[model samples]
Target: MESGRWDELERRVAALEAAAGRPAGPGEKDPTAPATFWALEGLRPQAQGSGAVVYAGTFRSEAGEVDWQYAHHVDDLLGAPDAVAGVDEGADRGDLAQVAARLAALGHPARLAILAAVLRGHDRTADLAELLNLGTSGQVYHHVKALTTAGWLRPAARGQVAVPAERVIPLLVAMGVSS
Candidate 1:
């Protein structure tokens, strides 16, 4: 949604909260939270009992309207080894901080190009500089340092750089670079 419209909606929600004499605190329930929570709360018993439970909700604002559905299945994968492999339902402040830092490191186009070059086997500083048409190796090193600090790259044998094994797929996915 457009920023202007989102801002307007935020203002409206704040106004509503103030009128209700319960101004929301930081990290408090969002504008739609009360209604959504009420709706879900009403379904708690049914959701706790049986098969898959589905809840459909809709939110309308001056900015836009969103219709969403949530499905819950209790212990659907209790014994599955990989059930929680990539699930991140609740991340703490430190996890979010690290994620923010890593994403910031990839915010630059040059850093992305450097990562791409490394993925394509141009792992040396000189090779990356030549491939990216960077004026000097220093520029290439600068981007490399950012990526390395973000845990996206590490030193290999000799003076070459390499994407850590576990990060290779995630890095490509982040860059939207197809295999």
Candidate 2:
């Protein structure tokens, strides 16, 4: 609203545009940005440093939409936009926590043995129960539920279960079946 405020915003936006390898001009599109980047029309820049501007806003695309975002110093968006890396700051840590919780579910020897058995194509719960000497379909089912909830196992079909594809590699690596 104030004169300095607009100037500050402009300076910040210019630095961000430069860092992102975009030429500065109102309505001039960023050539390096993703095809969907122009959807960032409402972006308002905020200066984070003397030569750095953080363009923070939402981006819309067919993949859906991302909100509360930032585009930082990057040479090109033709690659990946150089933004914050790793787990997003606002991501549901609940999912990350799920990994450890899943590991804990698999921590039991009986469960681990069952997962190994299932992963080996012994899809029948009864078959796994017999292999583990755990006895009965009910006991195996209980352990199976634990692994399933943790995403370590999934129902391959009715009356049959299997490990998820993503978990297969990790399971094999944990069991030393993979290199």
Candidate 3:
């Protein structure tokens, strides 16, 4: 790439990263570059003025594979970070409450184990109980209900469940980022 193009790419990546509230790693390539951070770049316009939080990933497990990408306007996702410029108190109360509720649903260790287990093909209540050593199907059912109501998991074939295709990347990103 020419020096000018490289510089432009770097600037865009920086903008995207800054909007994402992520720190740049050493030797970080330009996210705005093609096949790199296409989601971020595509969201750049909608994320304009208010910025955006974007994440994407591909996951292959015993269950199968998931290729996903997602973006949320910063105003919709980050009202409490207090670090991003222009993040005022103007964020929608309902959205923050909903996001908080969803995060709260994922706050339990057993719940996370349930999600990880389901992602790995242990989608049945009994399979999840056995795989996670939860001791009882009732305990597994409690977590399943929470995850399902939170939209992290959904009903599938009889007696099984699945993480919706759209939530896959976000769920992984949430776990990975928090860890």
Candidate 4:
């Protein structure tokens, strides 16, 4: 892009920061430009009369002024270092591995659909089979075994299967459904 266009983008980002009530960081940038969106740090403070420092990132959505859709991305960008730094390697690895395994298990669309149905209170193998269009209870059980083995899913009290609370965020993050 031309320098003029870059400057304009910066201006728009700055406007977004002002509207967002806080300064923009790397994550606030457009997801399309992942590099710029996550690399901005150590911004100089706003000039004394400016109220607050505001750095521009990128425009995400047009539904409203200065789309806030990328706010969480910004937060995650900022928090990543600290999150990694503070990790209890031992404690976290267990969860991390579990999360990774679970995520991998649900990586397929069929498995993901089945898991979603389970999370939504579908329990019995018959129901899951019906929801997923699987031919038999055995097929649903086989897939459920895959998820349960990885700790990505479990059977709820009422015989409904659900994702464990602790695993929800990782699942969403893995699925790119959440930041």
Candidate 4 TM-score over all chains jointly: 0.44
List, residue by residue over 1-179, the lDDT tens digit for candidate 1.
99999999999988887788684588876563457566656666666534444445443433244455556564441322233453443344345557779889989889888877776677877778778888798988888888899999998877798877656655655565432
Mind sharing the TM-score for model 3? 0.66
* Runs off by more than 4 Å, candidate 1: 1-91, 177-179
Poorest 10 consecutive residues by lDDT, candidate 1: 75-84
CA-lDDT, candidates in order = 0.69, 0.64, 0.82, 0.59
Question: Residue 87 of model 1: what lDDT?
Answer: 46
- What total of clashing residue pairs does each candidate reach? 0, 0, 0, 2
Model 2 has an lDDT value of 0.64
Model 2 residue 158 CA deviation (Å) reads 2.1
| Model 4: CA > 4 A from native | 1-100, 177-179
- Residue 57 CA displacement from its true place in model 3, Å: 1.3
Model 3, C-alpha of 112: deviation from truth (Å): 0.4
Tens-digit lDDT string for candidate 4 (91-154):
4445455556766787667788886665555666668887778878887788888988988887
- For candidate 3, the lDDT comes to 0.82
- lDDT (Cα, 0-100) at 40 in candidate 4: 29
- The residue pairs in collision within model 2 are none
